[model samples]
Target: MQAWDDIINIAMIGTDKKQPDTISVPASLAEITTRIITGSEKNREEQFLQLASLLYNYQRCGISPLKKETAGTAAPVEEKKYCSTHAALALRDVLQDDNHSLLQYWLERCDSRTQIAPARFVPALLINGERNKKLRLLISSCVGKRGEWLSGFNTAWDFSAKQTQEEIWQTGSLEERQEVLQQTLVTDPLKAREWIRQTWQQEDAATKLVLLSILAPFADESDIDFLEGLSKEKSKKLQLFALESLRTIPGSPIVLMYESFLRSAVTIQKETSMLGFSKKNTLQCKLPDAVSEDLYKTGIDKLSSDKTWTDDEYVVFQVMQYVPPSFWEKTFQLSAEALLELFEKTDTGKKLLPALTKAAANFRDRNWANVIAQRRSVFQKELLPLLPLAPRDSYINHFFAKNINDVMDYAKETDEPWSMEMTRLILREAAKKPYPYVGFFQKVIAQIPVAVSTELSSYPVSEDQYSRSLWSGMSEEISRTLAIKNQINNAFTI
Candidate 1:
């Protein structure tokens, strides 16, 4: 191809300008030259493939010849000269420019590896640049030899652990080839879970735990059983990991299993408040009478007085998180007046009331309405004024918005971050939208906080530095558009 010849001639001409004996080819030209030197001559398609690869290499990776001289011995021996790599870099300057159009000519000339490559830098060629197609070809060519490629495109310049993992996962066969799979799981929870499900029975306990580590991304109700099954294994760490993982899944069936044990072992510790003492020394958390009260019979209250079962907050929070809000509704059914009396008696009772309100919403109970009506006068006069400035205000808002829609509307009017987050959650829950905080999204985007703004702005600077930079910038732009679409969908749902 003329382009290849031009590239080689330019490198030879620039040898003196670059450095003695160093023929520095420009970015795309070096690749073109390499293709001409190494390409097969049998078919048009094959030759074109070679040319395409050469162009990619030159534009993306640059040329390979650099002359390195040995240290002087002064004995007049022939100089140790390495090949010059400068030719590869010069081509980059041309490829990176917006108007330097070579892709059309390159595509037409190499359309098919031919006995003789086409001569026309074909003006009428119907080639349009495509990223995904080019990427697929690049991946097919570079799959196993990533380390070599990485040397040319250093990690600092093109770091993509996800891509590296994908290459191995798509090509490698060994399940025990743990690095790629482990990293995949660590970074992508859904992918890791699917990987585990695909290869679970075949893996050992240690491997299972490694796979389970991916579930750390977001815990849900379904993870409980997977964790519980591991608890039967002899490895205490695996069992513990399983047990710990269950706490994160909010609506998990695992709670029913642990509920009885907890009720029996734990007790309601006495608590006090700055508001002053009431008639009762200890507040009672009343429960609704149930046909199958067995669920409420966890021995946790029995051990409340004992200090022996101290564990991490995550452990306690696990049960607390999953324990259905409906349970509090049942407690209210026993005696609404008694519950009010208890709320007045202790600080813990005050904390427990909002939780009860949430439970009332979940269960859709009218008792909560009656209780609110009875306390309306005192609540408005005292509690309502202190709510915004109170230490537990955020928590109160969170619980109320979670359990009650009216309260969420109130928060929306206030337009605080907590309100925005709650609104987002509600939008996701009720409207099936991905992110409901449309206003919040708009606000943040318009005047992004300083902490995250600068990194966002300079993302495009790389491509001008390397022809490779252009491709990278294009890819990033596409990803940002997709992200914006997802946010828009979420806003609509909200």
Candidate 2:
């Protein structure tokens, strides 16, 4: 195994030197060059010249050496011919069967450019996985220059340039540098965060805003300090965006952060209502006008019989929903019943109460389930009767229908009204499923009472019933059973 591994590793490196993996190279130089040229927008001429010059210098004898020549004389014909000859030789040496030679040559040129002696550094920050301080310093130089160099690469360079670009981000401008920082942070989050901190104050407000925006992509608990600082901004927009960013760091101490802010600036009060709920200790905080408006628009309608809300309000309420139940213990101790009553009175009791209960349940609060159950009971009792019966079982409404199903789960505790309703649905569904005991369905059919069989005469019939006698000889019991089965089958088919 060891010998095989050694052979495989050796095959990976261009030299017989053992390495890790095979490189995935772009198919052609024209493709890579086209990507570089078309993808870049900044310093186009300079970048182009820089790339061409680097390629030229790295090519075998491609560059004409500056050597002693007769002053004011163009008599170095031999040298020019030799330079072309060597360039062709170098091209052959570098390009022949080399998959990643383009990147290798680029790195060699970069190393030569930064050399102080025979010893020189290359763009090995990503390649060698080294923490050499010079590599970080070089990255800083790129960032400080506003990431002007990054535009020259495209998706085709993702493999070769990915690491070097990321390392350079440690030095890249805070706002301009986020593009590079994005790739590295996923693999080395702690170091990426530290890099952000080292340059935090040096970045301007706009740059800070851009840097914070990326927090949602790769935020962790360690980012709380940076977020807290940004959240305290005097600008409302910045404060909102910062708060929004903190939301991405799930299970973090964001609520404590939010609570502190609310305590300083906002208050919530409860209003009396006919629904038997009135309490002053409501959870309240004022977001920016837009967020507040969004919450209001998304909250369940106060007058809708459905008692359901849209998805956006739930997202706005998610911060409270994710808070550990223990955090609410103090409130529970003060007046658990009062809090419960307030939840019932809230406009979105059906939606908010259940979520609030579940979140509290995580802390072993027994009342969480009890409170949600109580609200659920009122909802089932009051609203179940008004739900429309779909002519067919719809896939889209399956979940909502399921919720109602749970509320009215068969054989559970129920009054006559509910029992009667379920019996009707069961008969209707049973008929569709071809259940044999169609005669046993008298309870539901009797309640329907309109004599659907006789009523068929008053409705439109086939122009010639004699010829359309599809069920002419069937007994009443068999005919009724077949009709019910057909209807139920049709319902599900739709």
Candidate 3:
């Protein structure tokens, strides 16, 4: 230890200015550090290497007491079977990069089979969790109790939220406690809400909003009282969140409040265009010159006329936002499918699609969700969370088939592995698309499962100008990703 400390002191000043003198060492290590420490006195890099070798000697010789309590045998191994050595390697590759959706492929497999991640994976996973917040739950499931216990010792790995729920909740940092709440919300939303209420007064405005936002999906009548109280707050964000919370709960008072507004403000009065012309019957939205105090009090932001939407159009949107999409079915006298078509046709439907999309996602409206999801022209990855956890890759697959960006977007949304068909298409697209596609493919290639690499290479690209120019920059990136994947496969081959 003394010799190790001496090397460290000299290294701190660096060899550029300071060099280690001949130092005595243990009779055994004297020969070892002499050889290691002798020749590399030229520069700081050399001194650093010499010092590291000496420290390794100290570490090798220094063993803490065996009697010191072992991390009481790993938390009971999960009943789930351990994945095959091969699957674990695939997972290691997935976790090595930001492939949350691909990682889900492993997580869901373990979940479906009641399997656990091999214990060897916990250290790397713990590091992965530090950088990507999304990985923690999946990591927790795979690592089970063993990873939870292991994470606390390494500062880099310590953020794993699988253990010490109470200890972390009470004493961990704000982010830590928030993670506990998210996990708890999944298992016990009421409990999470009560916990939020217990500490509600202490959290800052941002934290309070986040806490409230957590209640979005599972929120019920049980949440209404607290959320309604928040809706009355002065801050617009707090008020909006409260309104959103209320909106998620079907037929909550806030929903009814908006429903009543729509009842009074909207009508289907039929009228003929000019005399003896075809009827101009349609959904008509009316707004009073002034809204009731109660309506304003309930956190409805009054609309100022805009060029795109009349005051009536804007008010109708706010009203529909709180009203459940199902309510629109009755109000408009149209089925969910019909309503989606209507949104495509009418000026008002276009205005209302954004509001309806939020409702469709939040209220878990299956029919509207399907229609809106299919109709969505661009990626709405956020909705993936609100939808069912089961594989929706078939739906995402349609989008991925159409655009390269879609390939990038949906892969991050769920844990489902790419279908063989999707893999073929991506390979074909990558082979033909020009240089700009190179940048996106390079990052995403690491995410492609190793199982696909053999097939990926088998694809035959035409020697056309576009394809040639495309693969020039792109193939190298793809090759790099595949090489790393091979390394992971080889390293973990047991």
Which runs of model 3 end up more than 4 angstroms from their true locations?
1-168, 171-179, 231-236, 272-280, 293-305, 332-334, 337-359, 371-411, 414-494
**What are the models' TM-scores?**
0.31, 0.28, 0.62
lDDT of 2 by residue, 1-494 (tens): 23234333444653324322212222333454455445557355444444354334434353466654333443211211111233223323323322132223322333333421111111222222123222333332222111212212322212223245555565433433665666557777777787778877777777767777775656656776777687567666667776655544544555554333323322346556677576454544343333333233322222333336444334434545444444444534545555557656546444455555545533334444444343342322222322333311221123334454444342133222323344334334333332333333332222222233333223232345542242222124333533443332232233
What lDDT does each candidate get? 0.39, 0.41, 0.66
Model 3 lowest lDDT segment of ten: 385-394
Give per-residue lDDT, candidate 1, residue 361: 36
> Which is the better candidate, 1 or 2, if ranked by TM-score?
1
The numbered model that scores best in lDDT is 3
Residue ranges of candidate 2 with Cα displaced over 4 Å:
1-166, 170-180, 202-207, 217-221, 231-236, 245-254, 257-348, 354-494
Worst 10 residues of 1 by lDDT: 117-126
Q: Taking the tens digit of each residue's C-alpha lDDT, what string does model 1 give over 1-494?
A: 34445445545665334221113445535555555545456354454445545644555554566543532323222122211233212222212321112221222222222211111211111111122222222222222232223223332313212245555554443442354555555577577566666667777777667656645434465566666677677877777677666644554555565454335432444456667574334643332233233333422232233344333222332334345444433533536666556555665455445544443333334544345444531221122222333322444444553344444444444423333334334433322221233333322221122233223333333223443444344334433433433332232233
Query: Which digits, one per residue and each the tens of the lDDT, describe model 3 over residues 1-494?
Result: 66667667766886677655446466766676566556644554675576577667677877775542655665655656787777777776766665554455456556555667788887777776777665565666677667767765666666654546767667766666777888898887767777888988888788877777766766888878888888567678988878767776886876787787777776655578777668744556678666677777765667756788887778777767666788878877878877677565656666767877776666777666666666663344445544443334445556665555755566544334455555566677767665545566544543566666566556676678777866755665566566665654453344
Estimate the overall C-alpha local distance difference test score of candidate 1: 0.39
Candidate 1 residue runs with Cα over 4 Å from true position: 1-192, 201-210, 248-253, 258-282, 285-322, 330-344, 347-448, 451-494
Error of 1 at 223 (Å): 3.6
